[model samples]
Target: MLTSFYKMHGLGNDFVILDERMGALPLTPDRIAALAHRRRGIGCDQLVTLHAPTVQGADVLVRFFNPDGSEAGACGNASRCVADLVWRCSGNATPVLQTRAGVLPTSRTPDGLITVDMGAPRTHWQDVPLAMAMDTLHLPLPGDPAAASMGNPHATFFVSDFGMVAQGHALEHDPIFPERANIGFARMDGPHHMRLKVHERGAGMTEACGSGACAAVVNAVRRGLAARTCAVELDGGTLRIVWSEQTDHVLMTGSATTAFEGTVDLAAYPS
Candidate 1:
C-alpha cells in the first residue's frame, strides 16, 4: 500500500500530513520515528493525520503523533496547517476543528495568516499533572520551570542563560517529569516579547514548536509577566498568542506553507 501525504511547514516546524482517506495506512512507533528521521525519512518534528471525526460537532479530527509516537493534544502551528488542509479538502472558508482539548474555530485572517482558537489555559496543579500538587506558578523544578498545560502536559522553564543549557547532559534522562516533557528555555527581552530555545522530548532541539509557544504564553500571562497578547520568538520565527479578553481562549496566529506533496510507501509503517 502507498500512503499519500502533504509536506507542510508552519514557520520552520515541519510535518508530514497523511490523508488516510487516500488509503488505509496505519502507523506504529518505529514507523513514526523512521518517518521523522532527518536523513533517512521525510524529516519533520511531527506527523499529522486527518481522520473522520469521532465527535458529532466536529467537521474533521486532527491528530498529531510526535516523532516518538506520542500523541499531543494541542499544537498551534500544526493546527493552522490542518485547518488549511481541511478547508481545501472541504472547499469551506471556515472550518471547525476538534481535538482532545475541545472545539477549535479556524479561518484565514486578513493578512493571509491561519488563526486558531486554542481554547483556555489549564494551569491547575492537577491539570498540569505534575507528580505531586504544588503552586504551579512558583513550583521548583530541578531548574527554573513553569509547569503548565496548553493541551497535553508541558513544563516551560526560563534558564539563567541559554548557552549553559543547550540540550546536553542537563535535561535528558532527568526524573522530574514521569513522561519527560518538552523543555523550553526562554529569555524575556521585554514586557511584550521573549525569545525561546527548546529541547523537545523525542524530537530533541528543533526550530520551533507551536504548542511550546502556547504553553509559554499561558504561563507568562498567569504570572503577570507578559500581557494577554504577546509574541513568542522561536528559533524558526515568531508566533502570536492571545489569551483573549472576553473568552479566555488562546488564539494563535501564524503562517503555514505547503512544502511538497507525494506518496510514501506504506510498507514502511504497516499495521
Candidate 2:
C-alpha cells in the first residue's frame, strides 16, 4: 500500500516521518533500514513514526529509528519537528510527545522557533548504563570525556580542535559504554557559545543532533566550561540550549522546516 511520508529537518538533521496515528503500519527493522538507505531509498538521517498517544496528557507517541534500523531513546531535532506537526494538526500550541525516554513538552517561541523541554540530563553512571560504575564527570577514556544521558547515552569530549572527532566511532563502542553512545566533539568558543559535531550511535555523523547538543551543554555546564544558557553551533546550523536551574530541564530551541512530502509503497521495501 502507498503510505504517506513527510520529509522534515531541524538544523539539517533530517527525518522521514511516517504518521501512523490513524492506524499502525507493518514496520520492521529491515523495512526501516531499507527506507533509510541514502542511495537506494528515501534518504534521511533517521526515520520517525508518529502513533496515537497511549498515555494521558500526551499529544502523540513518537519513535525514532536510525538508518541502521536501531531504535533510539530520544531525538531532540526530531521532537521539534514532530511537535510542529502535532500542533498544526490538532491546533494545540503546546504539544506533548511521549517517547521511550519520557514525555516531552513543547512550545513555540515568539520568533517562530520550536522550544522543547527535553526534561533533564541523567548524569548517573547507571543511567548512562556504562558497563561498570564510574565517575560520569570524567570517563576512564582518552581525552577524559564526560558522560550524560539525554534519553540516550552521550559522551562529550572537550577538544581544542576537531581532529579527535576521527576517533568518535571507536569511542562510541568503547567497553565502558555498554549500549554504545553518541560521541560529541565540542570546542568551547566562549562562555555562552560552543561548536559541536556528533557521531550518533546508529546514524553516524549527522548535520546536527538535538539530544547530542543538549548533552554537550549539560556536560559543559557541569565542567564549568559553559554557562547554563548556551548556543551550540553545528555543521548544519545553530541551536539555543538552556539548562534551567529551577526546573533542571534542558530547553532546546531551533527551527523545524518541511522539505517536502511524498508517498511510498511499503510493500516494495524489505520486511
lDDT: which candidate is best?
Answer: 2
Worst 10 residues of 2 by lDDT: 84-93
The residue-by-residue lDDT of candidate 1 on 125-241, one tens digit each, is 777667677888766755667877777666777665787456533553366556567677777776689787766667778788777788888877777778888899998889888
lDDT of 2 by residue, 1-271 (tens): 9999999999999999999988989899999999999988998999999998889999899999988899999999999999988777688889999999999999999998999999989999999978998999999897999999999999999999999987888888899988999999999999899999999998888899999999999999999999999999999999999999999999999999999999999999998
Q: What's each prediction's TM-score?
A: 0.92, 0.99
After superposing candidate 2, which stretches have Cα over 4 Å from the reference? none
Off by over 4 Å in 1: 167-173, 269-271
For each candidate in the order shown, give its overall lDDT on alpha carbons. 0.78, 0.94
Each candidate: RMSD: 2.0, 0.8
